[model samples]
Every structure is written in C-alpha cells, then in structure tokens.
Target: MLYFIGLGLGDAKDITVKGLEIVKQCSRVYLEAYTSILTVGKDALEDYYGRELILADRDMVEQEADEILKGADVSDVAFLVVGDPFGATTHSDLVLRAVNAGIQYRVIHNASIMNAVGCCGLQLYNFGETVSIVFWTDTWRPESFYDKIKKNRDLGMHTLCLLDIKVKEQSMENLMRGRKIYEPPRFMTVSQAAEQLLEIVQNRRERGDDLAISEETICVGLARVGAEDQVILAGTLRQLASCDLGGPLHSMIVTGHLHPLEVDMLQIGCPGRNPCIKYSYQDG
Candidate 1:
C-alpha cells in the first residue's frame, strides 16, 4: 500500500495520529520536498516520527516516479507532503500515475493552506478562486494570475494569493554546462507579491483601463501560519507591501468589503495593526 500523508501546517507533531502510525508502519518513507515545506527540518521530523526519510526532489517525483512507486508493489510505502497531499496538483498527478500502475493507495488528509487561510479571520466560504503568484524573471514575467484575481475581486470575493516557492532548482548556466548545480531555495513573501501586483496595476493604469488592484485595497499578510510564532497582519495592499512579515512560507489575502463579523474577527486577529490602515490612490 502507498500512503500519501499530510504533515500539517506547523511542526512535526502536527501530523495526525493515524498518519503517524502509517509513517511508522511503512517500510520506506519519502518526503516530497519541492512543494510546501514544514516549519521544522527533515532531521527534526525524522527524530520525531522515528522514521528515516528520503528526500524526494522534483526530479525524483516527476521524472523518476517509478522508483518511488517501486517499493509499494512489495511493501508499504509512505509519501509525506508538507500540507495536505492534494494541496499542490503535483501530488494529484502522482496519485494518477499510481492508479494507472494499479498500486493500492490511500490519502490521509490534513490542514492545508486551502483551509488554513481561514486562520486570518476571513470567512472560508467567502473566498473565491485561489491564485498562485510565480516568480518573475526579467524576460519571463507572466500576468496570468492577474485575470483570476481580477475575476475574484470583481465578484466581491476574497482572493487568496499563494506565493511561489522555488526549491532544488538548477541555474541556467549549470543546466547548460551539465554541472548539476542547484540554486538557493526561495520562498516569495506577501510584500513581493504585492509589489508585483501594483506593477501590473500601474501598467493597466497607463493603458487607461484602471481595473488594476491598488495599494489601498485591504490586504492581509500571514506568515508561518499554524506555528506558535505565526504572524498575521492587515493593512492596505501598499502598506502590506512594505511590512516585514518575517520568515518563509507567506500567503496574502485580498479581502472584499468585509461583513460586520469579518471586520470584528479581523480586528481581534490583528491586535497591533488594528484600525487596519487603508492606502490611498493619491499617495501613489
């Protein structure tokens, strides 16, 4: 049997009891590292879960999937994901491959960003489609996520902007040289995403369309959520663009006009940034 276990938002102890039992029962345990990451390191998880984990990079999971599934045919194998197994579509692809291979599989679900974003005091049901923000290169900046965010905003629904994370990625020169050099991992923060969004807004403003999101739009920044030291802040998009959210694994939310309950909940969540400062177009 193949187990897809979710290591929930916080630390190693966050794993469900059933998931932990499966981890110990499995003969081989692999942690899918390229997607979202847990707050603790692999060693920490190994010590806590009492299992030796093999780090599975993107190449291993995407290109050499057969190797991962090989043991499941003979014995129990567990593939652990940072959030829920299905949080990233990549895992779903893995499940598809496993199904095609006729491998018996079970998914153990846990708290993923999809639902954990509710910790920000926003109504989960109020959210519209979630969008992912990718890293922009000088030659390859894409605005595909803009339309989705715009669509959600136009419908008066909250937009959850999942920031991008680049892990175990090779540099262009290394790939060309066949050197196998890996670049430092990067996790996009809420501030960076806001800056890029404002850039797109500026471009649209120049085009005289004026539908772009502005800095004054109410935005919430969440960092290291589900962890003890998690930080949540609410302010204007512009204000949040400048705020230091601290550490990796950040997410942003562009809120629609809030309900009275949402306003109250958000105020309680953001004790320091209360009054939730609004940005102005005039400042821009």
Candidate 2:
C-alpha cells in the first residue's frame, strides 16, 4: 500500500496520531522536500517518528517515481509532505500514476496553507483564487499573478499570495553543462513579494491600467506559520514591502473587502502602523 501523509505546517509533533502510527510501521518513508518544509529537519522528524526518512527531491519524486512506488504493491510505503499532500498538483499526478499501476493507495489529510492561512483572521470563505509568486530574474519578470489578484479584488474577495521557495534548483548554466550542481535554496520573503507587487502596480499606473491594488491596500504578512514563534503583521502594501517580519516561509494576503470584525482583528496585528488597513472599497 502507498500512504501519502501530511506532516502539518509546524513541527514533527504536528503529525496526526494516525499518520504517526502509519509512519512508525511503514517500511520505507519518503519526505517530499521541494514543495514545502517544516520548522524541523529530517533528523528531528526521524527521531520523533522513530523511523528513517528518505528525502524525495523534485527529481526523485517526479522523474524517479517508479522507485518510490516500486515495492508499495506488497509492503507499506509512506510519502511525507510538509502540508497536505494534495496542496501541490504534482502529488495528485502521483496518485494517478499509482492508480494506473494498479497499486493501492491511501491519503491522510491534514492542515495545509490552503486552510491554515485563516489564522491571520481573514475568513476562509472570503478568499478567492490563490496565486503563487515566483522569483524574478534579470531577463524574466512575470506579472501573471497580478491579474488574478485584480480579479479577486474586483470581486471583493481576499487574495492569498503564496511565496516562492527554491530548493535544490540548478542554474541554467549548470543544467546546460550537464552538471549536478544545485543552486542555494531560497525561500521568498514577504518583503520580496511586496517589492514585485509594487513594481507591477507601478507598471499598471504607467500603462493606465485598472488599479485595484495600490500602496495603501491592506495586506497581512505571515512568517513561520503554525510554529510557536510564528509572526503575523498587518499593514499597507507599502509598509509590508519595507517591514521585516523575520525568518523564512513567509506568506502574504492582499485583502479586498474587509468585514468590521476582520478590520478589528487585523488592526490588532498592525501594532503602531498608521492607517492600519485599507481595502479595495476604500479607493472609492
């Protein structure tokens, strides 16, 4: 049997009791490392779960999936993910492959960013389509996510901006040279995402495009969510672009319509920031 387990957002102890039992009993356990990560390392998880873990990088999970599912037909194999296994579409493809191989599989779901993001006080139902912000290069700067944010803003729906995480990524030069060298892993900061967003807003202003998001738009910055030391900061987009929330694994929310209660809750997170929160409706 193939078991796809969610490790939750925080630490090793965050694993569900049922999931922990399965991990303890499983013969081989693989941790999906590229998509997301936990506050603790593999050693910490192994020590807590009382099992050895094999790190399944992007290449191993995508290119060498057969090896992962090779002996699953007979014995139990566990695939661990930082958040819900289905949070990333790639894991769904793995399930499809398992189905085609006639292998039995089970999914143990847990809290993922898709839902845990509500901890910031934004109603989950209020959020529209979630978008990912990737790292921009000198030659390549994509603003595809801006349109989605605008669409959400137009509908008075919240926008969850998932920051980019580059793990075990290789540079084009290394790839072209057929080298195994990997670039340093990078986790996008809230500041970085805001800078890109502000740049897009500038371009829109220059081109006379419809403006829903602006410097004063209410935004929330989250860091190391689900951890004990997790940080949540609420401010304007411009303030967030300059504020330092500290640590990795950050997420930002571009708010649209704000309920009275939401405004109060988010205001509490703003501390001393002025004009704490402003939504799209305020532009009117």
Candidate 3:
C-alpha cells in the first residue's frame, strides 16, 4: 500500500496521529520538499518520527518517480507532503502513476495555507480565484496574475496571492553551460510581493487602464504562518511595501469590499496608534 500523508504547516509535531502511525509503519518514507516547507528541518522531523526521511527533490519526484513507487504494490511506502497532498497537482499525477502500477494508495489530509489563511479573519466563502505572484526579473516581469486579481475585485471578492518559492533552481549561466549546479533557494517575502504588485499597478495606470486596485488598496501580509513566530500585518499596499515581515513563506491577501466584522478583525494586525480609524466603509 502507498500512503500519501500531509504534514500540517508547522513543525514535525504537526503531523496527524494517523499520519504518524503510517510513517512509523512504512518501510520507506519519502518527504516531498519542493512544493512547500515546514518550519522545522529534516533532522527535527527524523528525530520526532524515529525514522530517517529520504528528501525527494523536484528531479527525483518528477523525473524518477517510478523508482520511488517501485515495489509499492508488495510493501508499504509513504510519501509525505507539506500541507495537504492535493494542494499541488504534482501529487495527483503521482497518484495516477500508482494506480497504473496497480498500487493501492490512501491520502491523509492536513491543514494547508489555503484553509489556515482564514486565521486572519477573511471569510473563506468571500475568496475568489487564487493567483500566484512570481519573482520578477529585469526582462521577464509577467503580469498575467493581475487579470485574475482584477476579476476577483470586480466581483467584490478577496484575492489570495501565493508568493513564488524557487528551490534548487539552476542559474541561467549554468543552464547555458549544461551544468547541473543549482542556485540557492529563494522564498518571496511579502514586501517584495507588494513592491512587484505596485509596479504592475503603475504600469497599468500608465497604459491608461483603470485598475480596481491601487497603492491605497488594503492588504494583509502573513509570514511564517502556523509557526510560533508567525506575523500578520494589515494595511494598504503602500504600507505593506515598507513593512518588514521577518522570515520566509509569506502570503498576501488583496481585500475587496470588507465586512464590518472582517474590518474589525483585520485591524488587530494593523500598525500604528489608530488602525481602524484609517479604514472606513466610505473609503471602500
């Protein structure tokens, strides 16, 4: 049997009881590391689980998945994923492969940022299509996600922006030389995301496109979510651009028409003496 288990957002202890049991029983356990990350390192997880975990990078999971799935039909194998197994489409593909190989698999669910984001008080039902904000380069700045944010704003729904995280990426120079060397991992911070969004907004304005969002648009920046040191700040896009949300794995919420209760809840994270004073229904 093949088990795809989800390790919830924090440390190794966040694994569900059932997931922990499965991990202990599995003959081989592989941890999928590229999609998202846990607050603790592999050593911490190994210590808690009392089992060593094989780190499965992108190449191993995407290119050599059969090796990981081999003999799963006869023996118990566990593939651990940060957040829920279904959060990323790659895991679904793995399941398909398991099925074709006549391997029976079970998925154990856990908390992911998609659902845990509501800790900031935004109603889950009010969220529209989620969009990803990628790292912008000198000549490769893509603003395709802006259209999705605009559509959500048009319908008075909030937009959840999943910031980009580049892990084990090859540098252009290395790729040109046909070298397999990888650059360091990079996790996009909230401030960087805000700066990129503001730049896009400026570009759109210069092009004479009346955008639904602006510099004064309300946004919620969350960092290290589900961790003990997690930080959530609520303010305008302009304010967030200058705000320092220490640590990696940040996410942003572009709010639309806010409810009175949401406004109250979000204000708790706002900086300054009078947080709620700046935000009013008339402002929206």
Candidate 4:
C-alpha cells in the first residue's frame, strides 16, 4: 500500500496519531521537500519518528516517481508532505501515477495553509481566490496575479497571496549549459511580496488603470505560521514593506471590505492598538 501523509504546519510532533502510526509501519519513507516545509529539520523528524527519511527533491518526485513507487504493490511505502497532501497538485499527480501502476493508495489529511490562514482573523468565506507570487527576475516579471487580486477586491472579497518557495532549482544559464548544478533554496518573505505588489500598483498607475490596491491598502503579513514564534502583523502595504517579519514561509492577505469583528481580531496583530481603525468603514 502507498500512503500519502500530511505533516501539519509545525514540528515533527504535529503529525496526526494515525499518520505517525502509518509512518512507523511503512518500510520506506520519503519526505517531499519542494512544495512547503515544516518548522523543524529532517533530523528532528527522524528523531521523533525513530526512522530516517529520504529527502525527495523535485527531480526525484517529478522525473523519477516510478522509482519511489516501485514495489509499492507488494510493500508499504509512505510519502510524507508538509501541510495536506492535496495542498499542491503534484501530489495528486503522484496518486494518478500510483493508480496506473496498479498500486493501492490512501491519503491522510492534515492542516494546510489554505485553512490555517484564518488564524490571521480573516473570514475564510470572505476570501475569493488564492494566488501564488513567484520570484521575479529582472527580465521575467509577471503581473497576471494582480488582475486576480483586483477581481477579488472588486467583489468585496479578500485575496490570499501565497509566497513562492524555490528549492533545488537550477539557474537558467546552468540549464542551458546542461549542468546539473542547483541554486540555494529561497523562501519569499512578506516584505518581498509587498515590494513586487507595490511595483505592479505603480505600473498600473502609470498606465492610468483604475487601481484596485494602493499604498494605503490594508494587508496582513504572517510569518512562521503554526510555529511557536509565528508573527502576524496588520498594516498598510507601505508599512508591511518596511516591517521586518522575521524568518520565512510567510503569507500575506489583501483585505477587502472589513467586518467590524474582523477589524477587532486583526487589530491584535497590528503594531499599535486600533491600528486597523484607519481601515474601518466608519472612518470613511
């Protein structure tokens, strides 16, 4: 049997009881490392689970999935993922591959950022759509996500901006030269996301497009979510751009029409008391 298990957003101990038991029972355990990461390192997880984990990079999972699935029909194999197994579409593809290989599989669900993001005090139902912000190069900046954010804002719904994470990626030059060299892992921070967002806003202003967001727009920045040292700050886009949110695995929420209760909850994460007061409809 092939088991795809989700390790919740924290340390190794965050795994559900059933998931942990299955992990212990599996003969081979592979940890999917590219999509998202847990707060603790591989060693910490190994220590807690009493089993060593094979780190599966993007190449191994995408290019050599068969090797991981090999013999799964005869033996138990476990593929562990940070957050829920379905959080990323890649895992779903793996399940499809498993089915074609005549392997039986089971998915164990866990908390993913998609739902845990509500800890920031935004109503889940008020969110329209979630968009990913990728790392932009000098010649390859994309602003399509800006339009999605605008659509959500126009409908009076919040937008959840998932920051990008680049792991085991090859440089363009290296790829062209046929070199297997890998670049260092990078996790986009809330500050970086804000800078790119503001750049898009500036470009739209230059083009005389009706701006959906502005420098004064309210945004909530969350870092190291589900970890003990997690930080959530509510402020304007300008304030967030200058604020230091500390470590990685950050996410940002672009709020639309705020409810009074939401304003009250998010105010706790603000720099000062009643910081969200400026965003209150009553103020306008």
Candidate 5:
C-alpha cells in the first residue's frame, strides 16, 4: 500500500495520529519539499516523526517519480506532502500512476492555506477562484492573474493570491552548460506580491483601461499563518505594498463586499490592526 499523507501548515506535531502511525511503519518515507513548506525545518520534523525522511525536490518528483513509487507493490511506501496531497497537481498525477499500476493508495488529509486562510476573518464560502501570483522576471511579466481577480471582485467575491515559491531552481546559464548546480530557494512575500499587483493595475490604467481594482482596494496581508507568531494586516493595496509582514510563506487576499461581521473579525484578529480602518474606492 502507498499512503499519501498531509502535514498541516505548522510544526511537527501538526501531523495526524493516523499519518504518524503510517510514517513509523513505512519502509520508506519521502517528503515533498516543494510547493509548500512548514514553519519548522527537516530536523524538527524528523525529531518528532522519529523517522529520517528523504527530501524529494521538484526534479525528482516531476521527472523521476517512478523511483519513489518503486517497491510499492510489495511494501508500504509513504509520501509526505506539506499540505493536502491534492493541493498540488503533481500529487494527483502520482495517484493516477498508482492506479495504472494496480497499486492501492489512500490519502490522509490536512488543512492547507486554501482553507486555513479564513483565520484572517474572511468567510470561506465568499472566496472565488484562487489565483497564483508568480515572480516576474525583468523580461517576462505576466498579468493574466489580474483578470481573474477582477472577475472575482466583480462578482462580489474575495480573491486569494497564492504567492510563488522557488526551490532548487536552475539558472539558464547552468542549464545550457548541463551543470546540476541549483540556485538558493526564494519565497515571495506579501509586499512583493502587492507591488506587482500595483504595477499591473497602473499599467492597465495607463493604457486607458478601466479596472475594478485600484490602489485604494481593501487587501489583507498574511504571513506565517497557522504559526504562533502569524501576522495579519488589513489595509489598502498601497499600504500593503510598503508594509513588512516578515519571513517567508506569505499570502494576500483582495477583499470584496465585506460584511460588518468580517470587518469586526479582521479587526479583532489583527494584533497590529490599530483596529484597522476599512477603506473602499467609494470612500473617495
């Protein structure tokens, strides 16, 4: 049997009891290191799991997944994902492979930022299609995500922006040289995402295009969610661009049609809220 288990978005103890039992019994356990991350490091997880885990980078999971699936027919192999196994498409592909091979697989679920993001006081049902904001290179800037956010906003729904994370990425120079060298990992912060969003909006307006969103739109910046020191800041997009939430693993929400209850919740939840005053374009 092959077990795909989810490690919730926190420290080592976040693992479910069933997941821990499976981890201890499996002959091999591989931790999916990319896509998402926990607040703690590998050593911390190893100490709590009582099992040394093998780190599986993107290349291994994408190009060499069969290696991880080997020997699964005869023995139990465990694949540990940082969040719910299905949160990433790669894990879904893994499930298909196991099915084709006639190997039985079970998914052990846990909370990911997708749902856990509600801790900021936005109701879960109010969220629309989630958008992923990626790091834009000097020569490669994509703005399609802005359209999705506008669509959500027009429908009076919130937009959850999942920031990009680069891990074990290879530079073009090294790739052409056939070198295996990898660059350092980088996690996008809420400020960077907000800055990119602001630039996109500015570009649209400069082209004489009207936008549903603007600098004055209410936005929420979240960092290190599900952790003891998590930070949630509510303000305008302009305000969020300069605010520092600290550390990696940040997410942002472009709010729409806020209920009084949500405003109260956000104010109560935000330690730095100054009891944040909600702003809207209409206030102008």
Candidate 6:
C-alpha cells in the first residue's frame, strides 16, 4: 500500500495521528519538499517521527518517481506532502500512476492553508476562485492572475492568492552548461506579491486600461499562517506595498464587498481593532 500523508502547515506535531501511524509503518518514507514547506525542517520532523526521511527534490519526484514507487508491491511506502496531498497536481499525478500500477493507496489528510486561511476571520464561503501569484522573472512579467482577482471582486467574493515558492530551481545558464547547480529555495512573501500586483495595475492603467484595479483597494497580508507568530494585517494595496511581512510562506486575500459580520470579524483579526474602512469608486 502507498500512503500519501499531509504534514499540516506548522510543524512535525501537526501531522494527523493516522498519518503518524502510517509514517512509522511504512518501509520507506519520502518527504516531498518542493511545492510548499512546513514551518520546521527535516531534522525536526525526523526527530519526532523517529524515522530517517529521504528528501525528495523536484528531480526525484518529477523525473525519478518510479524509483520511489519501486518495491511498493512488496512493502508499504509513504510519501509525505507539506499540505494536503491534493494541494499540488503533482501528487494527484503520483496517485494516478500508483493506481495504474495496481498499487492500493489511501490519503491521510490534514489542514492546508487553503482552508486554514479562514482563521483570518474572512468567511470561507465568501471566498471565490483561488489564484496563484508567481515570481516575476526579468522580461517575463505575467499579469493574467489580475483578471481572476478582478472577476472575484466583481462578484462580491474574496480572492485568495497563493504565493509562489521556488525550490531546487536551476538557473538557465547552469542548465545549459550541464552543471549540477541549483539556486537557493525562495518563497514569495505577501509584500512582494502585492508589489507585483500594484505594478501590473499601474502598467495597465498607464496603457489606458480603465478596468485595472486601483491602489486604494483593500488587501489583507498574512505571514507564517498556522504558526505561533502568524501575522495578519488589513490595509489598502498602497499601504501594503511597503509593509515588511517577515519570512517566507506568505499569502494575501483581496477582499470583496464587505458584510457587517465580515467587518466585525476583520476588526478583531487586525491589530488595534482597526476594521477595514470602506472605499468605493462610485462614491466619487
């Protein structure tokens, strides 16, 4: 049997009881480290689980998956994922391969940021389509996610932006030279994502695209959610453009037309009880 386990957002103890049991029972355990990461490191997890984990980088999971899946017919194998197993499409594909190979599998689930994000006091049902904001590379800026946010905001629904994370990535120069070098892992913070969004809005507005979102729109910046020191702030896009949300693994929520309950909830969520003040374009 193959087990796909979700190690929840915070730490090693965050693993579900069932997942921990499976981890101990499995013959081989591979920790998938790329898509997203837990608050703690591998050694911490190993110390708790009492198992030496094999670190599966992008190359191992994407290219050499068969090796991980090998011997599954004879022994139980467990693949650990940072969030929910289905959070990344790659794990879904892994399950497909296991099924095709006639390997029985079970998913042990845990809390992912997708749902835990509601701890920010926003209504989960009020959130619309989730969009991923990626790192803007030189000469390769993409603004397509802006349209999704606009659509969500148009319908009076919130937008959850899952920031990008680059792990075990290789530079083009190194790749072309056939070198075995990789760049340090990077996780996009809420501030960086907001800066990129504001830039896109500014570019579109300069191009006379009146449909672009303005800088005064409300945005919520979150950092290290589900951790002990998680920080959440509600402010305008302009205000958040310069805020320092320390560390990686950040996410942002573009708010919608506010309900009284949501306003009350957010008032409690933000520090100093400052509820988001309403600002609409039509008022002018």
**For candidate 2, lDDT tens digit of each residue in 74-124?**
999999999899999899889999989989999999998889988878899
Q: Write the per-residue lDDT of candidate 3 for residues 1-284, one digit (tens) a residue.
A: 99999998989988999999999999999999998998898999999999999999888999999989989999999999998898888888899999999999999999999999898888989999999999998889999989999999999999999999999999999989999999998999989999999999999999999888898899888887888878788888888898887878899999987988898888665222234324434344
Question: Tens digit of lDDT per residue, candidate 6, span 178-229?
Answer: 9989999999887898899999998888889866367888788888777776
Ten residues in sequence with the least summed lDDT for candidate 4: 275-284
- Angstrom error of the Cα, residue 279, model 6: value is 11
User: TM-score per candidate, in order?
Assistant: 0.94, 0.95, 0.95, 0.94, 0.95, 0.93
Candidate 6 local Cα displacement, residue 176, angstroms? 1.5
RMSD of each: 2.5, 2.6, 2.3, 2.5, 1.8, 2.6
Poorest stretch of ten by lDDT in candidate 5 = 275-284
lDDT of each: 0.86, 0.89, 0.89, 0.88, 0.88, 0.85
Clashing pairs in 1: none
Count clashes in each candidate, considering only residues at least 3 apart in sequence or on different chains.
0, 0, 0, 0, 1, 0
How many clashing pairs in candidate 5? 1
lDDT of 2: 0.89
TM-score of 3: 0.95
Model 6: runs farther than 4 Å from truth?
270-284
- Residue 152, model 5, lDDT: 94
Q: What are the per-residue Cα lDDT tens digits for candidate 5 across 61-174?
A: 888888888999899999999878889888888898988888899999988999999888999999999999999998999999999999999899999999999998889999
* Superposed Cα deviation of residue 229, candidate 3 (Å): 0.7
- Candidate 6: give the clashing pairs: none
